[model samples]
Target chain A: MSLPKVRVPYLLLFPGFAFLFTFFILPIVNLAQTSTQTPIAGGDTGEYEQTFAFSNYIQAFVDNKEQFARSFVFATFSTLLALLIAYPLAYAIAFKSGKFKNILLVLVVAPFFTSFLLRTIAWKQILGEEGFVVPGLRSLHIISQQTTLTSTSFAVVAGMTYNFLPFMTLPLYASLERIDPRTIEAAGDLYANGITAFRRVTMPLSLPGVVAGTLLTFIPAAGDYVNAAILGSPTSKMVGNVIESRYFKIVDYPTAAALSFTLMATILVLVTLYIRKVGTEELV
Target chain B: MATERSLSPEARSILNSQISRRGVLAGAGGLGAAGLLAACGGSSSSGGEDTKTVRWGNWPLYLDFDSDTKKYPTLEKFMTETGLTAKYFEDYNDNDEFFGKVQAQLKLGEDIGYDVVTPTDWMAARWIRLGYTQKFDAANVPNKVNILDSLASPSYDPKRESSLTWQGIMAGFGWNTQKNPKGIRTLDDLFAPQNKGKIVVLTEMRDTLGIILLAQGVDITKVTENQFMNAVDFMAKKISDGWIRGVKGNEYAQDLTSGDATAVIGWSGDMFILASENEGKFDFAIPESGGTISGDNLMIPSTASADGKKNGEALINYYYDPMVAAEVAAYVNYVCPVKGAQAAMEKIAPELVNSEYIFPSDKTSSRLHIFRSLTPDEETKWAEAFQKAQGN
Candidate 1:
């Protein structure tokens, strides 16, 4: 039952390639087909035929440009926030945690034990009007009576940042942990100060992680609907929400597919430009 | 379950209802409620009349369930009597989502994992129109005659051939008693200054817009496009002006409980469950202008195997029994659609015999209006408009 030596690698790769073809590539192809479809004449609600209706993209984009803009804005904010929080924690765990590093890493991933939906819904309650945080802030004159946390864009962004923090932290931790301590000493030996040594030497070495972490955080954040659905009001709706409502609520499969393809294309282009600008050709 | 002599009827009823509420709340944390009754029965199907399993996909907390046993009492009884293994799943959160999940399979003539599905009235219409459901065998469902007169002739299934009414739902104003001391009876009251930015409305287009259309002095039963647009415009303005918080589904109950919403346009059964669970902290009222009434229909999808369909029909027939329907009505507190259920309730839960939510009187019934069925074109148009107003 053993495979020939030359064919062994191909045999080993068969399952992964088959999985990617079936679950990933097949759906993308189907989605692309659906994107170019037109509704059948005298047919049921969700029935469609492939007509290569490229105008579907134009129509979906024009109809949802505001959501498109809001999604990127929120994703950008959440990515920046996640980077600010995750970088320092990952740094501490990598360079300064001594023997407690593994425990810290486990703690970073501890929130994952619970379901993502549950965690997001928990945030909705924690920042809710009746939740202790809001009333406490109100009593301390930190927020006005009319001001609320839940159902606001701020809540949505906060939820996204929290949910995606581990995505940012783990990659950053791996890259930081891989940095040899001697590189920093070499910079210091060359008359670089602590801040200069860290910034010039450490930051460049971790560019791969920064590129990876930001991409991981931003791509999903841009397409997320649950945070907005649970913690945001109507004004904070994202493109993901539009696609969802179109597919389920309105049963507009053509429009939903068009939006999906558009979102995928937009994110791919943005990620390409981002990697090129950051000049990190190896990480992605 | 409460048999103490010192307890008043109201207290006993409250205790009984709380027991059910505990069950619902324990299992209900998110909109995606997936519950399997016992272990999933062995899937290998026997070829002929030996089918011993029935799988039903229904809304959460819709049946009479005992939390401690994690079993549906009526379903358990049905299994014992018919020697059938019943698998019930609380999988229907929204009509469109559930339909979207199985529509492709249904179109391909494949089993969508359930012998029976309970879709709301409008959705059932779509299923029947598309020939996606099988007509019930008249001999198998002999108790179908017990359907209430009002529900026996819905536009979707005039002859009761394909579907049976599961429960009638009335949508109106529900508010926190502490937040709205004066109560919310009309749209104006619902939009009062104190309730600004604290109001939640249903994602169901008919119920939310039906209430608004009624307040605008428009008959929801025959709403014109212009009338519907006006209601949609009004809702959009409220959402933009930060007077309404969210447009949500059954999860709106979370907002009500977490105090993110002070008032909502919600369903009667949910508000009743919330009120009982929270010590009467919540209340539901039919808007003075009237409220929307709809029903979820139980039907066997066409993809079901013949034996599966037969088992499904038997399950449907068992639910149509007045006593069994009354038992479910006592637990869920929705309007019972079985004609003799009220009389049967007098024996099972006497305190709920006259409960307006379960057995509305003439005055209560008069205030409830069924949102008329829509044309397919209008369905897409109106649903798009509704989602647009919600900023999706």
Candidate 2:
């Protein structure tokens, strides 16, 4: 008889997987389930109920369209700005610069040594009314004294940009570093100017990094409350603060969980569609 | 699927090793901890035949415990004399956060494993209504006389039957002297042009609005719908225009003290910290119109018993004893609810005893409107206004 092919030890994954399922997936599932429960007639829980209030999602979209739109606009603008800045640095590191590349790369990664909150707060102070940038602008008369810089949406975007810039830059560098320079030389020799050579050969190759870095920065930036809470004025508060207030400040867990799920679902659908449109072939 | 019978014994054993090692190792730590807990947990405070233990939870850094000093002098004395060991747990930071934690346990009518907890006045009222707490049996507390007469007949708990306040503090405006030496008398100062981008308000929902309503000359005791909109609209305008620096809570003091903030809506005690640190850099002032009032209270959790609860209640009572209360007041630099603690504090720290921030003068006292709970609509309106104002 022929020897039987061995089956994979797939069942072996169950134990480790079960641990993750219990800890991580279970809570998310529970939050979704709790979001569906209807409120009882008499609410000594009049405060809040696990009342599967689907209206929360509607309210999140309709009632607070300004906050939602602001978050999206912020995420989009910051990611685009980051890509503009990072692509050049990534290109210089990957194709142009030599010798001190490792040292420069280390310097790029150095901010990660400090706490994320601390760095963000530092950015806030640096951009405050009396901050280095604002005062310098005032003295030069670039912006007048009464001009509000900190405690606005403008400041929140600035803070988010400062904090997540490295996330965008590092990935772009990683992607660019993997591209073979000879292909670009070949393109240059054929008929291309430096810009054309970059557009055809370099940009396509680094698209994967652009996609990955954009997603990394955009997802966290959209949900960020700390940046908005500290840097933005009251009008600049985002969906994160809404969810936080629903759960923590107000104890309205059902609606909070509902808003949370809505955010998760929307991000998933948008990111997946973005990926398909961009196409994986050019990205790699 | 494995074709185990056809497999070599070693392969099956390795499979078992891979599966069991991680599971068993992970469980191993948990089991060890569980065993260790079982062994030591009882002796720590099982409440055997002779003695009892009471557990209490409070805010971080609220109590005066000198870090360089190894012992808790107050607790040490309580344990020595009463023969009851106090198990203090610093687990609470906010009223709502702690309430959310214990509400489920309370709903199920189970003990949250704490004998006493400290919540502020409005939260105490809500908790009492929900029956999450027990009424104090005054006869059991020998030191009940130390309870302040003013605190005894408050509306939340008539006859002082259930809740008791430990300290009272003024909730008012504390401006940066760097901005104005003329003093910010009315609520109008916060909205004034020169103070724009320099104003700081607490993020707390009720306190922020209470002061605003009072400044607008509305009756804060009864919040009318029209009154709420007027207050919210004014706040909304301030927020939308880049007139406010930022809204914050406890960190308000830090912002003010560092000169990051030129003026702020601040708590008296928190402001005192800045005042004491900066000397003349800051001033905690009660606005001429009105400001909110608040007191942190100690209450018996529902599970507290006649014996275990008595020991815990005595501790609050003990802290209120004239001399003891004065020491705590001076250390905290907050309003002493114990009427005579102010007099006793005067004998020791004359500056604090006379300070209106700590012990409000009669004129300031009359204008202070202790904040009450808002109807759901008021809160949502306020939240909506706050969001709109901040440009969120």
Identify the candidate with maximal DockQ.
Answer: 1
TM-score of 2: 0.84
Give the C-alpha miss distance for residue B195 in model 1, angstroms.
0.2
- Model 2 chain B lowest lDDT segment of ten: B3-12
Give the distance in Å from residue A164's predicted Cα in candidate 1 to where it truly belongs. Answer: 0.6
> What is the TM-score of candidate 1?
0.94
lDDT of 2 by residue, A79-102 (tens): 888888888988788767799799
Tell me the number of clashing residue pairs for each predicted model. Answer: 0, 13
List model 2 lDDT by residue over B1-392, tens digit each. Answer: 12211111222222322232223233334334334533554345433322377666766445544333433456667778777877666566787788888787778766665677889887787777778788777776555566665567666787667777877867778777668666576777766767877688877756777888888888787877788777778776776566667778786765665456778887876765655455456666667777778887888887665675777777777776777777666556567777677778767566455556556666657777866565444444455555445444
What overall lDDT goes with each candidate model? 0.88, 0.70
Off by over 4 Å in 2: A1-8, A36-42, A45-53, A92-103, A188-193, A281-284, B1-54, B70-91, B109-113, B258-260, B303-311, B346-348, B373-392
lDDT of 2 at B55: 68
**Model 2 residue B27 lDDT score:** 31
Q: What is the lDDT, from 0 to 100, of the residue B384 in candidate 2?
A: 55
| Candidate that would win on TM-score | 1
DockQ of 1: 0.83
